[model samples]
Target: AQTVTQSQPEMSVQEAETVTLSCTYDTSENNYYLFWYKQPPSRQMILVIRQEAYKQQNATENRFSVNFQKAAKSFSLKISDSQLGDTAMYFCAFMDLSGTYKYIFGTGTRLKVLA
Candidate 1:
């Protein structure tokens, strides 16, 4: 069984501050992909960052970075210099090549960028 967990159902940070959202997963497979998605009021899912299970280094994009611990099965997203536009619902996702070409998403963490 594969599952993702976002313990924080809601989070808030001041504008221009940094915030980290935690995500823990449980999986028996070795090869997999972990991702963080952001969905705002537009209701569109945007990929924030992605990490491969085989990669030793974490994956980062612009102001977003991931702390991926393969051994602990944890993947957390760090948002630096958060802006008003960064306010969104963040979802931790997992995918693998087990013939199930679909993504498993966590309950989600609603992040608010307080001005």
Candidate 2:
């Protein structure tokens, strides 16, 4: 079984600053995918970023990036130039290729961006 762990229960950042959320996982399978999803107060699960196990290079978005350590099974999200709109509950997710596309998510890390 693959399980994701988020050490931080919550996080806060001043507007325009940067914040990094920590996430680690345990898996026996070598091939799989990792994801970071954001759920705002509206309760919609949105894909923030994704990384493949085979990719040696980390993934980066406009304001989001990931530090993927395949050896340690650690994938963290870094949000730069944060805005108040970025405040949301961040979840770490994992999926395997066993024909079942199910996501095992972390408890969650609520991020509050102070204006």
Candidate 3:
């Protein structure tokens, strides 16, 4: 069974600054996928970014990026040029391609971007 862990229960960043949230996982399979989802106060799960295990290069989307360490089973999210709108609950998740697409998520990391 693969499990995702976000060690930081909460984090805060100043506007225009950058913050990185840590995440780790335990998995036996060499092939799988990792994702980061953000849920604002509205509670809608939004995909932040995704990384394929086979891809050595990390993934980035606008202000979001991921640090993926395959051997360590660690995947972290970095939010650059943070804004007030970035405040939300961030969750790390994983999926095993051989099995169901259902994602196993972390408890969550609440990010507060202050102006």
Candidate 4:
């Protein structure tokens, strides 16, 4: 079984700054995908970034980026120029692409970006 871990239960950042949220996972399978999901107060899980195990280059989307260390089994999300709207509960998720596509998610990190 695979599991994801987020050491930080909660984190805060000032608007217009950068914040990195940490995530680590344990998996025996070699083929899989890692993801960072953001859930705002509205309760919708949005895909923030994704990384394929085979990809050497990390995944990035605008202000969102991920540091994917395959050997270390570490995937962290870096949010640049944080905004008040960026405040949300971030979850690190894992999906085994070869299997039934079940998603295993971390406990979650509640991030608050203050103005």
Candidate 5:
């Protein structure tokens, strides 16, 4: 079983600033994938960054970076140079490699970039 949690229901950041969104997860499986997704008004879920549970190093994609703490089961996303276009609903997701390949998603956090 795997589960994802997004602590903040909403957040706001100034344009060109940096903002971080926290996420946590629990899983009985030994191997899994953690991900952050962004959904703008277009309603398309875009993959921001992803990390393999077995990896000790965090993952980064351009302006998006992740701080993955395996011991604490914590995965947080940091967005640098945030643009107004970055405003959207961010989701934390988990996928297990436990044969079932099940996916569990978080409640999501709505992030706003104010100019």
Candidate 6:
């Protein structure tokens, strides 16, 4: 069984600053994928970034990056140059490629960018 945990329920960041969202998971599977999804008020899950367990380099997409610690089973997201549009509910998710291909997601972390 795999489980994702987001310690902070809510986070606030000043506009133009940077914020990092913590995410930890427990999993026995060796092959899997970790993801950070952003869901705005519209409720659409947008893929922020993803990291494969086998990849040594952390995944990065523009202003979004991930710190993937394979041994510790930790995956955290960093949002740089925060903007008002970045406000949303972020979710940490895990998917085991060797299993049923189901995603176990964290409760969520609500992020707000303040001007």
- Which 10 residues in a row give candidate 3 its minimum summed lDDT? 94-103
lDDT tens readout by residue for model 6, 2-77: 8899999999999999999999999998889999999999999999999999999999999999999999888999
Over 4 Å off, model 4: none
TM-score of each candidate structure, all chains considered together: 0.97, 0.98, 0.97, 0.98, 0.96, 0.97
Q: RMSD to the native, candidate 5? A: 0.9
- Candidate 2 segments whose C-alpha is farther than 4 A from its true place: none
3 against 5, candidate with superior lDDT? 3
lDDT of 5 at 40: 98
lDDT of 3 by residue, 1-115 (tens): 7788888998999999999999999999888899999999999999999999999999999999999999888899999999999999999999989867878999999999998
Clashing pairs in 4: none
Cα-based RMSD of candidate 2: 0.6
Q: Put down candidate 4 lDDT per residue, 1-115, tens digits, no spaces.
A: 9999999999999999999999999999899999999999999999999999989999999999999999999999999999999999999999998769999999999999999
Q: Write the residue-wise lDDT of candidate 5 on 1-115 in tens digits.
A: 5678898999999999999999999977778899998999999999988999899988989999999999899999999999999999999999988787667999999999999
Which regions in candidate 3 have their CA more than 4 angstroms from the true location? none
Instruction: Give RMSD to native, each candidate.
Output: 0.7, 0.6, 0.7, 0.6, 0.9, 0.7
Cα deviation of 23 in candidate 5 (Å)? 0.4
Instruction: Please write out the lDDT profile of model 2 over residues 19-106, one tens digit for every residue.
Output: 9999999999878899999999999999999999889999999999999999999999999999999999999999987788888999
Model 6: lowest-lDDT 10 consecutive positions: 95-104
Between candidates 1 and 4, the one scoring higher on TM-score is: 4
